[model samples]
Target: MAAAEVSHKDLETGPPTGSEKHTNGVGSKVKAHRTKDAQHGDKDLLQNVFIGAIDAGTTSSRFLILDGAGTPVAQHQIELDQSYPRPGWHEHDPQQLIDSVRECMEKATADFTSKGHDVSDIRAIGITNQRETTLVWDTETGEPLHPAIAWPDTRTQALVRELKEREGADELRELCGLPLSTYPSAVKLVWLLRNVDAVREAYEAGRLSFGTVDTWLLYHLNGGLEEKSNVTDATNASRTMFMNLHTLEYDDKLLDFFNLDRNKLRLPKIVPSSSPDAFGKVSEGSLRGVRITGCLGDQSAAMVGQKAFTPGSAKNTYGTGCFLLYNVGEEPVISKHGLLATVAYHFGRDKKPVYALEGSIAVAGSGVKFLMNNLGFVEQSHEITDLAATVEDNGGCVFVTAFSGLFAPYWIDDAKGTIFGITQHTTQGHIARATLEATCFQTKAILDAMAKDSGQPLAELAVDGGMSASDLCMQTQADIINIPVVRPAMRETTSLGAAFAAGFAVGIWKEFHELESINQKGRTVFEPDISEKKSAKMFKKWSKAVEMCRGWSDEDEDDASDQE
Candidate 1:
């Protein structure tokens, strides 16, 4: 049978009724870009099926289509607009996020067909998203009660402190594999229930729906309230502070600790990262009717994309935030250190959940964004390296990027961003160099802690995400860590991970080793070029900066003390 031709205009679709509308930015219709110039083949294209992945990230929404061999056939991305209403608070228009996903999927699928591939060959769709970003909406009206609370938002710090004071509050670490911090969804949800009038009313009326980005996209992609496609993968659910790490289900004690009335809010069902039926089918757009068979948090997806399935293997993703995951096999290790114990992946109910110790850095690529938008140092993010290249090094400068406080190893909540060793010789280049070096320094710190936590020194660190594109940054990472830094030819591992999960469900890829050859044609390895003494000296300077940055938030504490 011949494949049907799809018009670009036919890709535009409407949102759920009563949902907020979005203004089209690029074009009125979904656009297409051919991945290859090959002619159509006469064989049954269904046998040569492709898989799709939706990477709903903090900064952008991306859609990727991959063939059986894990080669990308089509790709499209649209940057998302995030609003910071106040310092340390971030938000996104939930409806706009859903709209962006639909647009990217439509455009990328159109591109797949333009390359002479069959869109019908897209067997299933997978989702990988920014974890811990919380959202709530009206179940009946399909309308968000408040803006989506971003993962980096720190509005609930006071609440976290109050919870910390409560007896047995620390017990939650063992239960949920997370500390009582503002980063978890449980605290964010509590803040919303108690503060937001709309959320409060919805809670009282029992109409509120809560989820991370994965659940939000899954809910709407499965036709919102109509299809009741409210589900989240185990990987995404693990960050919620509600799920029991042992059972992979919401625990009653966890709920009671947060004082959440489960009857008032609807929690999405926890399913495997890759499932045959749970995620449901895409209701509308160019790739309409495609089943969403897999879902994962962005970091877990990157680990899978890098094929870091074996124990002791690790990878770090440098996105809006930086996340390093050290795979710890099937058993969850409750972190004694300030790291997080999280589910790496869950193949299915029959298989045990893979676990990892995670170190999260709040500012990474956003440090570059600050230089671009806030300081006017550059117009584009990639231009940051050029500015940094002007300087020999950080010029004896150190930047401790604690925009939302620090995470992992040093859980310093009282610290803010600080720049040290500024003099008459300071320039934008020095600051840019310091900014990029801050990330590398933090990566070294996390790896140090990972080595202690796992009892295994990292052989090499596999890297991905936007900032990993900078060779200067990678070399600096290698130099500071004194370990080789590795990156793939294609840095879109987050999206590829989702595609791998979806493809696995449909039998496109049989085993983990089968994906070993995907995108292996060209791999870049940055070996450590600096002596250990020099690396230690550089890291010591960074450590001094971090130490000095602490207690900067004490003024706020003093103001609160005065009120008392």
Candidate 2:
């Protein structure tokens, strides 16, 4: 990709100073006009200002440098250390998350500058992070009072049940567009406040601050409480079970339901996903002086990167977990089905916030991780697809990847990871194929539920993320769902999404329509190869396996209850 041909800075010289022209279409008050670079005088002043996106994912942290055309120029990633001290508990050191982000940014920026690109040309930083991962930190010292509670942590299942048992608990769905689930940040926060003495003491002393990874990153980036750069985007705030889907702000009643006192517990101010200056600048580091311009939750950022901006547009991201989001336009649609209602993205003020219905599958690429790390089936994750490709099919094997139990449409808490119909004939390839097929089966289930909840059938599915890199898995997904699976040329759509939001905010791309022609090279499409009847038959077997695995945890729990 060449330079942007035209620069926003060059266009500013046109007309009288402070002229108002909507150059970038809707809501842009910036002066908009094409002008030859008078300073360079006949030479092209390469629109070298690149946008950087910090992808703080579940398992790792990544920094991607994207040009005006959404092409990655440089990238660096660091795998995060995850701790599981107890069964079904997940946590990450808050400082570790911040350190990973900093390292990624420094490494990526070093690469960017080594390529003769000016570090000063890095205009802004965008942040997209794992949603619902709760963190509470001290205001003065900028240290986490407790480890960042991972989004998948189910330690609060009992507390969630207590909330559900409370009167008016059912009204939370209507109030916050979320169910009383253990996945939400509020439940995790409640657990921290109740169980962790440090967190409770911090809150009581009015020095506690709550934020997801995005807000945490922003706080540190902007120099912490002294700089007062604690702000979360609408997309990230939507996952907290505190923000109102309609107002796009934190609801008092929802906060009260969680028993959170705002005065004692300082929450980040909810801001638009993309803004000119709210998130503040990187006060220090190699990328110092770069402004933090855009922020979004990971799934919502994936939606933006895939350009699923229209009503009924949908995309599935197969990261550590898989998330399928169906865009429902400006209005939030509360899901009667098992899906979650969330803000897809908000460009800025005056632009309507896009809403979505999302179905989250907790075991996607991580299932492959289990094969690589726990079972030692493969040296690397990519080999699972290669091993599976050796076998024509699953060989009558069915794997229910419920390591953390099923999510979305099938909220089966009692199920564990199960491999059914494993005969002597079952080889490594059979198990490998079954594992990959398990994700596809769950995806098909989510898609079915999405269609039911949204009252709209998907024409095609746009996919990105680590697992979508496998052609076998994608083909299996297409076959199981009987829908075309579309993948972008650059599979780093998650990072690109954050870049897009940042670039748009600073007028690099000018308008949303400008992105339609970008990042389109080498896009692949997988059409359904198997017959619908065959798909149905295979899915029926998977459904049966899912049923067979249910209540494995419950039986033990029931025995314990009886003993009590």
Candidate 3:
């Protein structure tokens, strides 16, 4: 079949309802993304059939159509505008996300068709989203109650501090494998309830629905306005403190402790990572009626794409924030260190789930953004990579890119980003090099903590994503941790992971063994080249930089004044 003819008016941006309805802003962007011409192919397309996967991330929304070989033949992506409404408060116009998804899907599908590849062959779709960004909407209208609160928002810092002062701090961590930090969704939910009048009234009226991005997108895609139901995958649900680690369900104690009504809020049904009905179908768009079969949090999805199912497989993603996940096999093991327990992926039916240990660094690529935006360093981010690659070494420099705070193993929210070991000899090139080193150092630290918690030695890591594209960064990661760092020829592993999940769910792919059967070729491995002693010395300097940044807060009085 030739590519299905889709029109701009087939769907209009309104409030989300079943299948295709979306918010007004989303419709406008779709209006803006209108393309006039596309290439037409004469030769027969490549021989294959596959599924579509949507990878919704912090900075971008991407669509990937993957074949049985796990390679994306055509992909399209669009970046969303990330807004800092206030200091330490992060938000996204939920419409931007919705429209971006539509735009990406249209472009990707258009590309495939222009190449004579038929869209009918796409069996299903998977969704992997930036986890922990909270959205509450009207179950009836499918309208977002407020701009989506990003995962890194510190508005809940005060709430977290108060909760930590309570007696149940340690117990909560033991129960949830997460500390009393503003990072978790539970505290964020509390802050929203108390501060946002719309949310409070909606909660009382029983019209409020809450979910992470995946749930919100799913609802909108499936007929949001009329048949709105909040639901999420196990991988995303694990990030919320509301869910129990063992049972993978929301805990009554957690809800009561937060003083939240169990029924007042719309809670999505928690489903397996990989299952057929686990995801719903997109009711609208060029690919309307496409089945969304797989879903995972971006990190967990990346874990799947990396094939880190067996014990010891690990990887790090460098994006707006840094996340390092290590697959730990069958059962969930609570972390002794300041690490979060997470689900790697759910391959089988309700029984025998796989688990993982994760260490999150609040800022990685965001640190680079800070350097470019705040400090006025290089013209563009790509320039930083080129400059860093210029230096043979860091020239005895160490940079702690903790502009926000440190996470995992340390959990020091009090620290600030700092540059250390700078002297007359230091240059921007060295500074750039140190910035990349800072990320690698923190990654190694989190991986170490994951090892200690899981009691499993890490094997070679498989990496993907924008940051993993850097050869210098990859080599540095290997040299610092003294392990082989593997980068896939195709770096969109997060979407690949979602596609795999959806494919498995729809029976297009039977088992992990079948997915593994793909050649999985062109993996570049960066083995340890630096001496262990040199690595240790570099770490010692990085450690001191962190210590110097400790207690970078202005004053307790400032925080108190803000509250008043």
Local distance difference test, per candidate? 0.80, 0.80, 0.73
Instruction: Kindly list the per-residue Cα lDDT of model 3 for residues 334-410, writing each as its tens digit.
Output: 88877888777876575467888888877767666666678777766655666675667888888887655677768
Residue pairs that clash (backbone atoms under 3 angstroms), model 2: none
Off by over 4 Å in 1: 1-47, 554-564
Q: State each candidate's clash count.
A: 0, 0, 10
Q: Each prediction's TM-score against the native? A: 0.90, 0.90, 0.88
Error at 92, model 2, angstroms: 0.7
Locate the minimum summed-lDDT window of 10 residues in model 3.
1-10
Q: Answer with 2 or 3, whichever has the higher lDDT.
A: 2
- Candidate 1 lDDT over residue span 344-401, tens digit each: 9998846778999999888888888888889999887777777787767777889998
Q: Who is ahead in TM-score, 1 or 3?
A: 1
Best by lDDT: 1
Instruction: Give the Cα RMSD of candidate 2.
Output: 11.0
Candidate 1 contains a number of clashing pairs equal to: 0
Ranking by lDDT: 1, 2, 3
Instruction: Evaluate model 2: give its TM-score.
Output: 0.90
